[model samples]
Target: MNQRRQKKLSHHLFEAILTGDARSTKALLHRGASPERRNGDGTTPLYLASVQGEAEIARLLMEAGASPDIESSGPGSDGTPLCAAACWGHTETVRQLLAHGADPNLREDQGTGRTPLEWADGGPHPDTAEVLRAAGAQPSPHRAVGAM
Candidate 1:
């Protein structure tokens, strides 16, 4: 029950998510591991899955009760799991998160003053921008950098 041991277990679970190892993830959860636990950067297993565009991983995390809307708790908390997926043009990931109740219009990290729409704009991928807009992301006056 030491802190270091718990963190090690969490990190193992986190790695399983990134590798899309559903079986291991399931086993970890079944053993009462915490999927919602965050990393040093406040990145949860869901966040890693979204960023990696691993649909199975994302699904597993969601089913385990990880909050799709948990912002980074870091500066701005601007990084929603959906936004991170969108920023990477992970259409399926974005769709999954939205279906699971992630707010497309979730506010961006503070000071950055951006939205998922803005994040999409900052990327070079047109498909991502389109997907975000289609998901009801709007054009705020904030105008994310490099948005077309």
Candidate 2:
């Protein structure tokens, strides 16, 4: 497919994921919408799904070969899919990403920021923090949530 058409489909796929419409995401994937595509804001499809706590859509994206650790590329991007899910207390999404091989300790902010464990620990999700710990994530001395 052409790049333009692919971009359009990816946009729609992102919308579907954000809206929690698994049927639409699956249809778009069948229509060649790429799970690996980045949004105009430079966030990966899986990142959007993770931030929204859309575990089903996240699973679909992973099945379509979306990388669990693909960081957002746009200016002010939020880092990896793991970061988004952990910071937001999306427990199931975090679990899905980790099961799919997302690095438990990936960080943004040029590596000075919190790891996924820190994000989870600093947020309302102590449960998420435990999950990261079980996956071998080291604790951050900073606990910097940063209003994210």
lDDT of 1 by residue, 1-148 (tens): 6788778879889889878888888888777667688877777778778888876778777887888888665342237788778778887888788778888788746435456666666775577778777778777765536653
> What residue pairs are clashing in model 2?
none
Summarize candidate 2's per-residue lDDT along 1-148 as a digit string, tens digits.
9999998999899789879999999999999999988887787888889989999999999999899987777665568888888989999999999999998977766576668987787786999989899998987655545554
Best by TM-score: 2
RMSD to the true structure for each prediction, in A, is 3.1, 2.4
Best by lDDT: 2
TM-score of 2: 0.89
After best superposition, candidate 2 residue 146: deviation in angstroms? 9.9
lDDT of 2: 0.86
- In model 1, the runs with Cα more than 4 Å from the true position are 1-6, 73-78, 110-112, 144-148
Q: Please report, in order, the local distance difference test score of every candidate based on alpha carbons.
A: 0.75, 0.86
